[model samples]
Target: MELPVVHYSKSEYIETDTGNKVSRKSVICGSQNIVLGGKTILQTGSVIRGDLKRSGASNFVVVSAGRYCFLSQSCIIRPPCKAHKGAFNYFPVKIGDYVFIGESSIVQAAQIGSCVSIGKNCVIGKFTIIKDCVRIEDNTVIPPNSIIPPFSVYRGSPGKMVDELPESIREIYEARCKDRYTKFVPSVDA
Candidate 1:
């Protein structure tokens, strides 16, 4: 039997009942290696490259995102690469819950912990480890193999930790993520 082909509006994204709003235009490769936890929102033009598999390991996962993660417009999430014992290998990019990746940001980090806020046009270098509750300002360039400690505010080129994040903003960021998910509905043109 043939299934009916359903066409959606230009402004409409693929919204599941679990509140995961993924844009139809987004390119998500290597589905087997990519994991999207419930209530995740991948906005328009986002590119998630999970097809770049690990060396000599066909069954390894390339990318994973936890609940309420928002990948904004034109953002590119790629697996980190490294040289282990003179052999190049691609590592997984693991993202925790309540993460917001801003527009046109290129992330090649190995680990991005919970409640991380990355601003627009940021370039996160390969193998960078971002701990929980980190706030990265806009247009920052994080160096490779660097570690951002928890609750730190990072900014500028080569990304420096400017200040510490207040405990109060944690709740605010969480609520903002939830609210954005709820309001991230398709735009219906008149």
Candidate 2:
């Protein structure tokens, strides 16, 4: 699916050499622990909390996103935390290519596979695992530790598998992600 072209203020975003466009208003903590593959877009007011790492002295990624990932406005992406040995420990968040998280979504999932489209105002609970080619509808709330299978559609609070996706869903999501990335441009008047 092709998305409409959206113009943004040139001064508000920074486009990197690897084709990653990050908004200046986005709050990304612990930059060293955050890895973004090429052609990823982090829109304004998005927050990536890479600062919360596991309770240990290991230098590793807290949030690793693949190519062409899109995090919409005001979205919060954080590492999932759990209590282990009477202490809190943060785990990594792995997002694959062509994943689109809609506006105002809070995602604390452990893993989100390729070609996943998450709609607006959703809450993906901590430790949730979403496999490839999945579509989560708007305002959905996935429970913690839930594993969403591949080629499925989930909706509503305590999101459940409402339908199965077509085999071509991966291709469709990949194209959509590419189209959105290409269409996101700086306004000429800016």
Candidate 3:
């Protein structure tokens, strides 16, 4: 898919050596524990809570994102937390390549597979696992501990599997994420 060129102010972004374009307005806590693979985009107002880690664990990664992932504006990517041994501990959040998380979405998922497109204002609850080639519709609310299978379209309050996706969705979704990344450019007037 070909996306229209979207211009952003050059001063508002920080392009890393590994080709990750992160908005300065985004709040990324505990960056040392957050691993963003090459060519990922962290848009304005997005929050990655890498600060939340397992209790008493050292040098643990809280959030890991793969290449060409796009986190839209105001989205929150936080690890799921649960009580363990009478103490609260946060788990890791793993996001695969070419995943696109839409605006205002709150993801507390344990894992999100590749080629997934999550729509705007959705709430992916804690410990949820989303498999590859999945599409989540806007305003959907997935319950905690849910496991979404591959090649499915999920929506609604409990985020049920509403439809099935084609096998070619992996290629199509990857192309869409690549196009979106390439089209998100900086304006000429810095």
Candidate 4:
């Protein structure tokens, strides 16, 4: 199926390549500092913010989206402070290919590998490294600077490696990505 060409308001500020699809409702603030790569799809209501650096420049929020990666509704991507002018400035948020970021999650200064699934309302802390094929459950909080070993299931507050998820559940989650939903706005009754 051919993807529809949507008119996004912050067009001048955003640099989108051909074949890369972003929903009209997805917002990219601090556009001067944000970059979206080819074939990436930033779904409805996702927000990308960049902080001010000490040099009076904007911090760079480098989002390297691998082919077929999908960032769902209301996902927040903020650059690390170390990557800015502050003492806490850190590196950019890098997401690998075929990764899925669930609704309403916050990903800051973290490295997410390919085929990983971050659930709804999850908070990925600064400088955290999530290895490939990891599955994080909904509402989980991953601490800063922590390492999540590859091919594991992490759940609960300050997420920890639980156990290998059942193959059935894993398959279900993976299949969910096939049906990506766009936002719907209801009309007012006059």
Off by over 4 Å in 4: 1-17, 50-61, 82-90, 165-190
lDDT of each prediction vs. the true structure? 0.88, 0.96, 0.96, 0.68
Q: Model 1: per-residue lDDT, tens digit, 1-190?
A: 2223323364658776766778888999987899888799887799999998777788778999998999998999999887789998888999999999999999999999989999999999999999999999999999999999998999999899999998887787788777777655544567
* Residue-wise C-alpha lDDT for candidate 3, range 63-181, written one tens digit per residue: 99999999999999999999977999999999999999999999999999999999999999999999999999999999999999999999999888899999999999988998998
For candidate 2, list the clashing residue pairs, or say none.
none
- In candidate 3, stretches whose alpha carbon ends up further than 4 angstroms from where it belongs are none
Q: What is the TM-score of each candidate against the true structure?
A: 0.89, 0.97, 0.98, 0.70
Ranking 2 against 4 by lDDT, winner:
2
lDDT of 3 at 16: 98
Better of 1 and 2 by lDDT: 2
Error of 4 at 15 (Å): 11
Report clash pairs, candidate 1: none
- Lowest lDDT block of 10, candidate 4: 180-189
Against the true structure, candidate 3 reaches a TM-score of: 0.98
Q: Give RMSD (Å) of candidate 1 vs. truth.
A: 6.9
Query: Could you tell me the lDDT of residue 149 within candidate 3?
Result: 98
